[model samples]
Target: MEDSIRRFFARYEQFFLRALAGEPDPAEVAGLYAEEFIAASPAGVKAGKNDASLIEAMRQGHAQYRAIGTRDMRVRGLRLSPIDEMHCVAHVAWRATYLRADLPETVIDFEVHYLMQQRQDGPRVFGWISGDETAVLRRHGVL
Candidate 1:
């Protein structure tokens, strides 16, 4: 189970790197989450579906990141707890690095919790909880 968790996160890292690039493959990014999922953040909880709207949202998100000079994102660490045979929770530590034309690189560290479903196809992120990302980004001058 631990090995499986590591493998899952490793794949997620690859997916993120590809999916959040300047020219992302939406289909490949969509594969990271379930068809229907929930996102909980400082703003609120929202039920979302993997559709064209979601794809466009992802694209816009990447655009924002690019605008902020974000060059890469990384999973710093992960802790997993099994909810059941077919479900689990993951606490993930993340870091995003940005570059500037006249300043040094900036790195921001944050954490997120994910509710995952273990399917025959693989692990799927059905829901995730996040902190006040906007404030953090703004404080870091990356917003």
Candidate 2:
């Protein structure tokens, strides 16, 4: 079970790296989540569905990140706790680096907690809670 959890998140980390490099086919981002999921943060809590609209939103998000001169979103660490045979919660620590010609390169640290469901196919993120990304970015002058 530990092995499976590690492997799952390892692939997730790769996806972040891919986002900066402009790969993973873009649609692959939505594949990280389940059919329905909940996202919570300083902004508010919202329910989301993995669909075409979500895919388009993700594509736009990639563009937005690129526009901000995002260099890399790297996973610094991860801890997983299995809730049951089919459910797990993972806390991922990240270091997001940004670089723009006009500003000094900045690196921000943050963490996100994810709720995952495991099935015959694989593990899928069904929910997540994140920190104040907007404030963090602004503090680093990336906003």
Q: Which residue pairs clash within candidate 2?
A: none
lDDT of 2 by residue, 1-143 (tens): 55666787788778867866877565766768899999999899999899987777876887788899998887889898789999988888888889999878898889999998986778889999998888888888999
lDDT of 1 by residue, 1-143 (tens): 55676788888777667755765887876777889999999899999998898889988888887777888889999999899998888999999988879546999999999998888878888999999999998898766
Sliding window of 10 residues with minimal summed lDDT for model 2:
22-31
Residue pairs of candidate 1 with colliding backbone atoms: none
Give the Å shift of residue 48 in candidate 2.
1.0
Q: State each model's C-alpha RMSD to the native.
A: 1.5, 1.4
The reply for model 2, stretches above 4 Å from the true place, is: none
Candidate number achieving the greatest TM-score relative to the actual structure: 2
Clashes of each: 0, 0
Q: Model 2's lDDT to the true fold?
A: 0.84
